[model samples]
Target: MKPSFTFSSNSIRLSYVSWICIFIVLLITISLLPIIWRGLEDFNPSDDYRLPYELSYDYWMFSCWCKYACSNYPIVMIGDSVVWGQYVGLKETLPYYLNELEKTNQNYPLCANLGVDGIHPSAMLGLIKYYGKSISNKHVILHLNLLWMSSKKHDLSDTEEFRFNHPRLVPQFYPKIPSYKAKFPQRANIIVERYVPFSSWVSHLRLNYYENMDIGNWTMQYPYRNPFNAITFQIPYPEDKPHSEPISWIERGMTKQDFPWVSIDESFQWDSFKKVIKLLQSRKNKVFVIIGPFNPYILTDESLNRYKAMKKDMENWLKNEGISYVSPSDLPNEFYADASHPLKVGYEMIAKELVETESFKNWLDK
Candidate 1:
């Protein structure tokens, strides 16, 4: 009753051509993926400046900006790698523990961490100026390590580029220094890189791949939940101490031209340190300082005396200014992953001590 519907030879040929065209198009698209997804690593600032794909200050700044843009976090932690939780996971960081403490205490202060590796007081001063307003009228727990004041590696120049480029709700105030040459992006590059799937995928490969190769743990490829932060679940053992035998405490395994025990007051860092305090006070942000844990194994009799003297000087200064502070005096050697950074147990102890403090409680209550 009806004509049979079937493809003629010419129509069949046309269908085959169409299918081939679609396959070719997909092949071209797949070939362009890497170029289209060229990420942060593609733009190396200089020969000396290496881009960290994971748990970088840039990522932290970006995350904070996203979280705080619409909502505010009452508690913000600021410091260097120690506070950033290097060699640890996002869940093991001090801020994460503090959040746990908040839940345990039945409080509702949302905590945000802005710690980046190698951040000193001068950069911190600049950071506060830029992002302090976001956390204004909230409790600011600032990690004050003497190493920032004492370490030759910690300088304003080290932070110049990172501060200039990292995302912030407020405008960045870059110092007009001769050394600073990188131009600031009109929009937040960090946010752009984060949302783009290709860039983040590349970052995960870089962060996790090299890390596994370094530790001979290639088998444990997907060890972290938050790969953006490069947070790893690898449990470090005592045999895994970075050095074969303990190196000099002051030297910390690296041999630099300048000794570490140099006077903090004489360094230009003191000026930035003072500025950080002044800026926080001016912003009406409650500033609470916590001196991070140092590996006791690094201390010899001589280095111990120098460390104590520095601590005493810092304590006197805080006391005179009536700045509430706590310096943990008894961190054990076993709790350390390196000369300065602590293991999970150490982070837990630090968070526990800070959250239980009357001063921190009073500041939050106020």
Candidate 2:
């Protein structure tokens, strides 16, 4: 025999209402978290500031930075690690040099560095589309690195699973990345984060405070430690130093080799890059493109010929679009850090070339 428990209709209705109230409270709290987090930190970024290297994957923080830059700066330099100055210090980047040049004329239009490491055109498309709403009605200096089209795998045309940077920034499902093996749930979560501030805020906490781990995993790893103790309430600053010693690729033992360059028509990266330009233009951005001064010195003759043909086609397209651009002549071999990235002096030279170019000067004047 078992004891029976019963509830009146009114009592059952009250229980349901209690759960509903609890759910509403939870929803409101989650939505308010991102706002609360923003208030907790005073994020007045300096003129020379780029996104901290560690926070590169934190799109929420990127959004915050982008908004601030858009509001403050008239010119924003957007691209991958090349523009970010991989082998140069914070003050040695292209944007910094551009700003220094601008000082001779006027200081009103300061250039902001919005580059992220390993951000290929595909991820870049997603990044600007979702996180860069504040960039409209501004002057954009967009960099196009040809190294991404130098191979099938680099262009993301290979249909095999492999690791790539900023998976969270790329399209998850529709244009499938055969190499991206994230399961459905993970893909869905990524989509949610793009639209939901709360989800991204949680990710910021995980990245900055919890050793890049989720609360559950962090707890398991630190068994007896209090989870709250993990948060230091301080955002880590990016070191102003270069990631690599400022050395030319030749000095690093890199040799000239034949690259299996992909054609512009078949290039996935090229297509994505065109779309990025269109997206920026649609937002009323005055777009100026800087095609890479790729290290022609490091290319075998055949590879160099193929690269030249590809570059010519790109120039023709830009001309048809009436877009202002500059494909700077390659710097001396000693100026190259690798096939695409420039050394510190290389950045300075590139900036000087840009300011001296008739087209670049015209765009700036406008």
Q: What is the C-alpha RMSD of each candidate to the true structure, in Å?
A: 12.8, 2.7
Best by TM-score: 2
* lDDT of candidate 2 over 1-366, digit per residue (tens): 665966456543558888999999999999998888876866777778888888889888888889889999989989999998899998999999999988877756479999988899999999999988888999999999999999888888778876888888888997877677899999999999989889889888998888899999999999999998877767777689998888999899999979888898998889999999999999999999999969999999999999999999999999999999999877988999889999999899999999999999899878
Instruction: State TM-scores per candidate.
Output: 0.57, 0.93
- Runs in model 1 lying further than 4 Å from the true structure: 1-70, 107-110, 151-259
lDDT of all the models against the reference? 0.56, 0.89
Q: What tens digits encode model 1's per-residue C-alpha lDDT throughout 23-90?
A: 99877775566444333333312111111324344432233342352154566777767776665665
State the weakest 10-residue window (summed lDDT) of model 2: 5-14
Give the number of colliding residue pairs in candidate 2: 0
- Superposition error at 237 for model 2 (Å): 1.4
**Deviation in angstroms for 103 in model 1?**
0.9
* Model 2 misplacement above 4 A: 1-14
Q: Please give the lDDT score at residue 215 for candidate 1.
A: 31
Clashes of 1: 0
